[model samples]
Target: METHKSLSPDPNPAAEDDDHPAARRIHRLALHLNPPQGLHSHGDLRMLACAAKGKQLDVSTQELTEYMRGKHRDVQERVYEYFNSRPDLQTPIEISKDEHRELCMRQLLGLVREAGIRPFRYVAEDPFKYFAIAEAVGSVDMSLGIKMGVQYSLWGGSVINLGTKKHRDKYFEGIDNLEYPGCFAMTELHHGSNVQGLQTTATFDPLTDEFVIDTPNDGAIKWWIGNAAVHGKFATVFAKLLLPTHDIKGIADMGVHAFIVPIRDLKTHKTLPGIEINDCGHKVGLNGVDNGALRFRSVRIPRDNLLNRFGDVSRDGKYTSSLPSINKRFAATLGELVGGRVGLGYSSVGVLKIAVTIAIRYSLLRQQFGPPKQPEVSILDYQSHQHKLMPMLASTYAFHFATLHLVEKYSEMKKSHDEQLVGDVHALSAGLKAYVTSFTAKSLSICREACGGHGYAAVNRFGSLRNDHDIFQTFEGDNTVLLQQVAGDLLKQYQQKFQGGTFAVTWNYLRESMNAYLSQPNPVTSRWESEDHLRDPKFQLDAFRYRTSRLLQSAAMRLRKHSKTLGSFGAWNRCLNHLLTLAESHIESVILEKFIEAIKRYILVSALEGGSFAIHKLTEYLSFQVRNIARELVDAFDLPDHVTRAPIGMQSTVEAYSQYTQYAGF
Candidate 1:
């Protein structure tokens, strides 16, 4: 657990000339920091620079980076160091796909070597540490983050989770050392979510004692595979295992299983015989990942290549699995891949933080309409502007805290093979992944719009943030499809056989609500009528719970009726939208709970520890004035202006403009 320390601002107040803008800015920012013990202002330290230099301030400093980075300051600083050390990984806009891929590959490996971000290392004890490091990569450039994720989290992850001792011995060291560049070839051209529909086949040949793998049709070709176009030499291929009926056999359907298949020569980087790889070409985003489509004609690999963690094939071609049900085995296998989805959730928020940072920084500097007598006001003064950006800012904080919890839970689940824990982690990751990514897409757009024309500029970096994260909605698993899985799992919890976990609690909440509604239904209280209740945590949770329960009940009944009339698929299709709503509501409820918990732990508890009467008083003040304290909540994101990399997003607009003039030779 090596960690880096953040550089503290120089404590000597009088070191710089009083006339110097930077010095003056620091002095003014220090003013708010030391404000009479009890009072805290959520002002951006950067905006203080604007105030010192006699510039109009458009945004409030209340949304401070110190608050956002709170406990993770060390990790966040390390992230900054990693990116700053590798200037090549910084983003403007990538022009060539090949160049993007090469640069990302270099940085991915370099981060591992220099920063000790062991992307390939198995960290069953402290996955949150690994996840935080991975998250920091995204803030620099999403391509680099994604390329690293593909290499370690997906490709190498398959070998680690599914493979036995032989597979680990042969591949783990190589994968960690970058000796083997690999891709996870799971999603086919025709089948993305529908794993059962995959057409690629790995048939046993008893005489050859090898599995002959083939992509039977164009649709079966592995598509959108990262690291496949240029870097990958091997792949963890997921295919239907077609076994001879006469050969000693098990598994009722004998469905999909993972196998390690070498696709290219390590030295020459050339495609092996019977292997055809085609570039997927430029995508809307993530051009750096080298996504490609692979068609296997008759690629043959040894029987020992089967990643035999959950299932195995005997030397005599006997297929044996500890898990009797094919469906259960398939589920356990896919659960191993949930790491990718969890990584994506964290990555999406990392990018969104950048987008919101840029927008907020710019809003603080730019001015528009104001009273005739006064200097034109900062756009942040307007309710409309604050309304547009503040909630998103709050949501970002919420998502980050929620993601931290997800990483912790994921680590806990990995230590054991508890089926319930696995299912819980998988379902929770799927739901959170959908919620965070969908929020990322929408929030980026809102932040972009908040910045007006400047946000559209490539230099501001919203273009990169939006373009890269836009694909995240459909990345590991389509958000809509993933939500359906969550909803389907939730619906199952209503059955008599259902046990309890995080998602199952949503069912319990719903059942209690239904019972209460039947016993004593009352008119709903609106925020207008019950403003005090709006501040109550129980009220918020109950409201969200009611929405989810109502949706789940409606969807379940509709689905049941449809199933009786039509087929199962038709029933599901008809209730798809309702199911999606139910899933989304459930996820939002979880996020809200996680965020409130964070506030209690990080904010309230920390304040109490300080033993300052003022701090305690401030906490009490915040409890009743959420609207006035919105900036404080946003500040909890702890994102600094430097990371935003936009001129308008700097600590001081005047200083930012001065630097621009110097750079442009104006």
Candidate 2:
């Protein structure tokens, strides 16, 4: 394979000191590249830090650009050299006729194992791990495919295991060990997100003690399933379970049930008698995964194959569920999707980190304008450049902090079986996933643009990163759809408060609504004298604490008022835009609040570092940089300064002092 040369190391020794201009620039760049260390525990922080180091954490963006242009071919050559030196890994086992399929799967899985990363790490690393892996393999198509497959299996397997112990036992180990590569096939061509409308059926065959699975028509065929085209041996297929005596052919008496259906003959490596498989041809991104369509024609599996945690079947063809209501049962199945959404949100945060790291490093090294009497100036020094980049940097910090909070909430909810908490997590994940991924996509594009012509090249990282992130807007769940789900939940909460509910709840709702209103520019501010209170940082932070409350109330009120004239869909659609607005505002408020809280915590560490102005400024800059670095930094670093402020600050000073003393005479 072809490789590019590496950039020569900077020869100027004075540039390494903290007080030097280059040192200051490097410090700023490092903040973006690595972020704060305390957001997460030290172990995770170390792992991410190690990964960043492996990627040559200090490489200048201009150097990266030059490397991309083959001006410094050795840089690219070194990248490939590092990748190739690693032990070859196995891909997930596949039974395709093509030998390369097996070879590729083995290689892919080997890479994951060699990285010593869990599948969930992909969520934390977002687009970077995938992009890097792709670059290693010399194919973006393969990278995208493998990413989707990894995500699909990891997220899907987690949900399956959590929701049903039986499904977990039957499939979890196989999935994790790469024994039975599978797909979570829920999307049908006719009904993508509308799960209730799926036409595929799993009829109880009491005589044979089997579930007769059938995709009766073209529309019912499962499409867009990762691994289904080649690698997948089985699928956790969702179908409307048909009741024998109800005379309702397409109706689901027990809601949607998952069945572990074997699509290919294990021994023969061929499609089963009644199953049809078709590969989804190349798409915009993520091509390494074999996304395929599957159609079942009277496919049959043993009755035990039904993943019936929420619902079950009797030998006499009777349908039953622990949850009597079909809606609730259906919800039990769909609810697991929240985990996937959460994982995706985390992935978006990772993507943002990589983008920011690239942009910040590029900003520091790339010189643009000449001084009136001299030479070029660093683009990073320009106010406009900082303006374009800083807010995004701030927002990334916001995204990271918010993501950590969400993950904590998710972990808590997972540990407990509280339906209410789960629902809240569901709404939060969906809203945040939509908001963060969309923002990350936009931010990455901005970073790319900020890097100018060089950003377009694959080697500089932006172009490929952008391509890798493109699916974030749609995958896991469509951003708009997720926003609507958040809106729906908000509306439900609002209605409870609208009925003269508890003072605490009502006050919360009122507070949140006011915050939402304030977030938007309004001309009629004089109507409320308390509006001035909104400007207070403390008050703003408090308002943020309850950001979702009022939007839900407003949406509920609007829906209720419009319900008389507009049908449910029409009323929802009419208020949908408003609901989405509320969701976005609510999510943003949470992010802003988290950012402030994180900053406060960091500031405390700074204060304890002693009252020196320079120390304080350094702390402030570092805190903001942590915010800029956001989630990934949180994953890798610990808040050591807060607990050991004196020692930590002393250590930092000693390190700087040592460096200065060493170079004093030079």
Candidate 3:
């Protein structure tokens, strides 16, 4: 079993200099915040911190990049190099939406032709390579990245996963070569998150041997479909499948199924008859992709167009499925498309790396106020500055490691198709997608503020990165809904503990999580504030496990209790806030465990030192360790300056300031 399903405090012995103004202020703030009290210090902690800053960072940038990029490094680097070589591929500042969209389309084609990105072919041979191509493109232009995903990962994915051999033979190459751009028409105007509630209909017409795809109401119009406004000729339309009952007035609702519906003429590039397309228009970011709304008025496609991997309707309009129920078929179908969530998780971590890379690099070069009469210190030197960027930097590294692990697990699950493995991967991907994207989205803003006015400049790229990434938390599954899914899955695992059910590899950690919960609040363990204790990876892991188990137990009981009065659905709604906390606690534990497992010896010992689950707060002594190795740690992320495109991210301080000044027209 995979060991996933996948820390304390300190003392004040540093002898607060009662007369020192800074120390006095610290005490006052500490009191106001009502901080836990234990006055002690780590003896020789300063010496250890100094040692950590040694002559050179022990880790190699190439080695770290190799680990983070995993097995897809070749494809990643190839795509990266292709874009790096294309001067025009670099997006311009404040271009019109049409121009930006045109450029993105151009880049998408050029990347396919020049970069040799065979997205569908890669998905067949190695999905990681496909994701690598997407991730690499995203690092350069997110709009283009999303455009590629909409075509390859969603529309093509639905065909590949839901359709069988005939579908693959006919459409795979076309989809791969861009001969038939496609959209995943899943989200409706009135139903974004609730797939089961969608009102679009695909009624089987036995007489004509066709399925009449219809938007029953305005609510059923497909909205926010990438590639629908322009370029798309086909779509994987998800709608309720209905079968005629002996030509009577009644039809049987067979739940939702995916059908290949052509929305435009391949030869003319014109909207097909009975299909109306409306451009979604420009918004906060990612205007490069042509997002549009789609409404189908009794559009007809052949019965064979239904992707029949899970269910099929015979010529006579009799529906049959191997799956026992609509819910099971829906779950299996959606499970196959978990690749999107995994890809989003991978791409989100990349965004965080760039955001932190730019922010940290700028922080190291830009100077601000310092001791009187002394040279102004680089903002990176101030404790407050380190607090802003260092922990984010650490968590970036941690999330990167976790995302890498997630990629491996997803690959394993896809190839094996083991029910247990699929469940683990599904829940893990959902949790990480929600957690990591949300983190990266917020981090982008924090990074912008950390850079002050410069980050606001379009040249710095923070604002665009911030805006483009905001939608990540909503798509691939809304963050809140995804977290609830995680929490729901976790609650099942909680119940299984009593059923004597063995946990899956992903949730294997659950087998032992209860031990920590049972023994936690060990008065001594809770108050252990020494540096060594906090730094010990075991204590950190144990503390995280304990917190998660504690929350899981509490949340499960809360739901059970609420159900007594509010009933199941109402009970869930009542306990949602508590459940989300449980889900976050579980995911963070998985990430920290993976981070420690991946690179414990690295200077990021403090990466999660002050994490919420920590039993005891870390001391000021640990800040030096973070400061000493923060540069080396970010370097290990190995993002080149060219990819960042921020004038303030140069290695040389003088060059950084000079470039920023030039960008500012000074």
Candidate 4:
């Protein structure tokens, strides 16, 4: 951390020293500085000595991670310890798929029993705390994370959101107490993002006061359903609710509704009558989830089985819904699943953090070619290595704040049933889920390559991370489909502006575009020309805003022109790539803007509370010394040694080297 002489000539090297208060603070944390030798320039050796000692920014790292953890640190630590203490809950060593599934279920049931009626239980009261549990599980083994999410976040959460008091009374206690297991049967063999297109049907029978559910064809079968292979006793099945023949008008009028259908027998763990369930044999990863498929011939359920939150069936076979139209009702019903998207976004960022943490720490310990007969330099000292991993490190930090903001916004939206709020949250969550997952996918790939041969090892964790997280880009919602959803929302906001309307945060780009287009003597683009412009929040914000506005404005124009000639669907398909770009740019702008806001807020609060100088200096490094903030930002992810589980990412360089040498028999 101590400033040293430069290897390359500088007119005023002290200027670099003057700008970095973080280096000064981190310098004090360094116990000693020692340089390994052979014919290196005195100045170069001095710099190497500093670099060797420089990774220790103990206070800054802890403060930032503490800030990230916020009020949930105590609960997070307790949960981490609970999982750590239970070896059975941990991933096994090279087990077969059957063994993996069985062990995973046993571990899941243990967690359910342990977390009975608590925040980590079925339908958790605190969304952040619930996500924290997912994050911690994902850090060590994502297969376990997916299994846990299926049980609590997706299946149990559906009952909490879509079910009424009676439904809750019948299911919630059992779900919380592990008396029954479940799956969310939403995705069909042919229909994933297009939930309305699912061919599963649930027809009402007035005489029997029941609903007959059937999967009409192969395409309608529920597919890739977690917990369906072995454990689930019930499924929150989504299907088109049909009225009696006399009451039917057309297909569009009938709505998709959720029903609590029995899938497996409780005592024997067997499939119920008319239900055909099969295990999806092997996957790229996440084998612990027991992914499976299901088809129903003629399953019957009591009328009260319908999750009657948004739509319901009358005793006389009439169809009624609180939502006015099918589309609105679809939005309302699907809105219940937004929490899963939000949690996925947060969990994706955590995955990237884990990947980069392992890569960066390995770079610091793994040595490579240097001056002949001299000690080899750490790989991290190379510019090529830095270029590959540093920006991703910064992005990891940016995504951290962005996802947290999304979580907070989601929490606020949950309190109100306003249609506008629901739509807004849906659009935002969709955008973030797509952006963060894609980012993590690419980041893990880069991190894997960055670590060279070692990264390919299962022990290193990147291989599993890459394969398991690859599904994230497609499931929950397809990334491309979700991006298109965001673009459609943006177009809606664009049209709303003419009607004297605006949305919470997205509308800014529209307003900014209009003002920029109409301004006298257009604003200069040279505002970013200065050497320090990258460090200026205003310059960064303006650049992001302008790029987002230009792309969106152009996208809207293209859609309009093409639609007039090719028709709406044809034009949309033709311009799909542009629309995707528009959505991506807008999301990137949002993340950078949110990052600036978070840093500003932390700085303001720290100043007011008279917080630690180290934390204050960390903020200064984020802004003023932005060029050198890579290591600090990565450390801010606050991944504990236990969570990393990589020998190279242990507590200290010494600890990592100690374990590595022993393992290598050096």
The lDDT of model 4 is 0.74
Top TM-score: which candidate number? 3
Clash counts for all predictions: 14, 28, 12, 0
The deviation in Å at residue 163 for candidate 1 is 0.9
TM-score of each: 0.83, 0.70, 0.90, 0.85
Angstrom error of the Cα, residue 549, model 3: value is 0.9
- What RMSD, rounded to one decimal, does every model reach? 14.1, 16.4, 7.1, 9.4
Which RMSD does model 3 reach against the true structure? Answer: 7.1
Off by over 4 Å in 2: 1-104, 111-159, 162-164, 246-252, 500-536, 542-557, 604-666
Local accuracy of candidate 1 as per-residue lDDT tens digits, 284-369: 88888899999998899999999989888887778888889789889989888898898888878888777776677677778898
Better TM-score candidate (2, 3): 3
Candidate 2 whole-model C-alpha lDDT, 0 to 1 = 0.58
Rank by TM-score (best first): 3, 4, 1, 2
Candidate with best lDDT: 3
Model 2: how far residue 461 lies from native, Å: 2.2
For TM-score, candidate 1 versus 4, the one ahead is 4
